[model samples]
Target: MVEALNKFQLIGQEQTRRYWETLIGSGRFGHAHILSGHSGVGKDALAFFIAAALNCKADTKKPCGNCISCRQFLNLENQALQLIFALPRRSANQTDPFTGIKEKEMILINEELAKKAAWPYYHLQIDAANDIRIAGIRKLRKDIYLAIDPGTTRVIIILRAHKMNMEAANALLKILEEPPAGTIFLLTTEYADRLPDTIRSRCALHHVPDLNWKLIREDLLQKKGVDPVQAEICARMSMGDLAAAHGYAEQDNTFWLDRIRATLNTLAKEDFVSVHKQVLLLADKEEQTDDSRQQFLSLLILFFRDVALKVKMGETVLWATQSQQMNKLFPNCDSQGAIKAIERTKNALERKVHLQLALTALFFELRKHLRR
Candidate 1:
């Protein structure tokens, strides 16, 4: 995978390509590079590509996949290449089932859970500044200084460089300022704001944009065997986030739609008790996962948004797919009331209110817009 970077489809960043090519052309491939973008973008993919290009054995522009160096890069067996991933430390109660009881017990007994779990873990937690203790910084410094394997350039890929505390950042800054020979550092971050100015200044930056919806939808259909209609719907909803689109297409969206339908039906029938019960069910189900809550809320928002869009455009309401059946259920709803209800729902979501509370409130509010 690393060897493939030089030739990988970088998707959207043409400018980034020129920047990297210029660096490579100048024999400065050993310099540190930073790839920053929003979550779900292909930053990590590009990092691997860059690493592969650096180590490519091709006699020409280097990452020739056919060369011996390319083979080593492909196998990820090259001693010169080191990949360190900094994942968040799991809560003490959460242990890999495969680990022995002793390991599990050790984690339970460990007293550092609170401190370790305070901040979301990034790709690299090396904080050379105020947040990183001197000991941790010293260890990283030593690791950075270790001699590279003979005849091979060392490449270190840091997955989330933003998680570093001040102490860790300072320690890293020192190395970046006076980088060792034969060393190339690759830092990938989703939240570039959290990174220190000094750290950002030391490395060349590359941006990876979200994948195009058209391409993402096609990929889903071709690679994942998703239905074309479903793929297009998911693609539009995901707004180019391929991972989210895939998840939406793979899951049973019908379940959520059914729940929304039930809620609307209960409200229409003036069954307040049933509406409360339905809200409870949704809240209970969503309590299991943040993803569930997010999906439910998103569906509800889109439902109302589409309804509002229809009313505003003065288009026939039949065009609103999700709300089409609601016409007979609430024949008295006025445009002003519908718009207000939509605005209220949007505000609740923006404020991060509890999903059930938001949904229940929206239901009652919608009653005002419905026929008596």
Candidate 2:
């Protein structure tokens, strides 16, 4: 069995790719492995590629994605592939993993899976589904030992593995200690240290590095068809996280950017009424207020960053297209104070403080600093 980790069309974690290629090429396809990294760093993608490669039947470059097994993996229809992740808490009387799941919850889960199938880098999320329950592991324990195609390699992927509750973690540990024949476990998590020492000791752990900003930018422009300007801006702001850059690209940033520019002028004049109204509008969305506010703050940070860059370096800025308006608003921009204020508000927001209050205080601070 040549269980080599062939290239998976990944963006750029060269070190991880080399590590896996060497391990798999040695024909020591271990029982369990963990690919750990921060969110948006392509751990899920690498795991999926490994699963596909394991079952691929190609003679030469494994995961010759056209092979039947690889196609099944790509379509997420492979019977030999078992995917596990966090789910809503099961009822006390429920024994089956799917017994107590609501229809809406199931629909949402399927939708997220579909998105993942389309793009392996897509982050899977379910509202209020915070932890993996023990029932799911018990179910997996039963299924993995059952009958399967003779040539098929059973690959079990547990995404966000750190989200496993204590009971689920213990149950999974037992299987990891003595996994069934022809079965392999692949776990991906942002916080690998959260796993018990015993569990970590049983698996080969590999760290997946964050994507380069240039790789992200090119992917946005070429793969996602994002406009060059928007792609450049989002990639520059993503801090080496591809998923965040993709999300930023999808958002209608112009709406928030216009408001930010207006808010700056309002603050400079100390127009409390207009400032209060603008903040209220941003904080009014009952469900999306957190994400909306964060997006607005991120854009504001970029705005001030451009100010500093223009003032000091005389270099090209992200919003150079809007130079006329920026120059009018920030004639003698001093962004340090304003940036500090924004960072403070951002920290408060993360702590679940009152959004409106935080925004109002931020505006007052910005007024003092940016007023010419």
Q: Which regions in candidate 2 have their CA more than 4 angstroms from the true location?
A: 1-9, 89-95, 102-108, 125-128, 258-290, 303-317, 320-340, 350-372
Instruction: List model 2 lDDT by residue over 1-372, tens digit each.
Output: 223222244677878766775766677888888899877888988888878877888875666777888888887778899999887775753245777778988998899999888777788888778888888899998898889899888999999999998888899999998888899899999999999888899998988887877788888888678776677667767877888889988865555657776776676575779989878877786645677777778778877877666633233334564544555676765677888889889889989988788888888888777764
- Per-model CA lDDT versus the true structure: 0.60, 0.78
For model 1, the superposed segments whose C-alpha errors exceed 4 Å read: 1-15, 26-30, 59-62, 87-140, 143-152, 229-240, 243-250, 257-290, 300-357, 363-372
Q: Which consecutive 10 residues in model 2 have the weakest lDDT in total?
A: 1-10
Q: Which candidate tops TM-score?
A: 2
Tens digits of lDDT, candidate 1, 1-372: 334433343445446655675777688465787888766556765665567667766655545656666555555556666554332333322222112335644454232322222211112222121222323444556676777656566777666677566766787788788877878888888787688889888888777676776776776677568765566556555766665676688765546667766766786776888888877876675353656755655565555555544433233221255465565455555535755675666666667778777868877876777663
User: Which ten residues in a row are the worst by lDDT in model 1?
Assistant: 115-124
Query: Which residue pairs does candidate 2 place in steric collision?
Result: none
Local error of candidate 2 at 95, Å?
5.4
RMSD of each: 8.6, 5.1
lDDT of 2: 0.78
Residue 227 miss distance in model 2 (angstroms): 2.4
Question: In order, how many clashes per candidate?
Answer: 15, 0
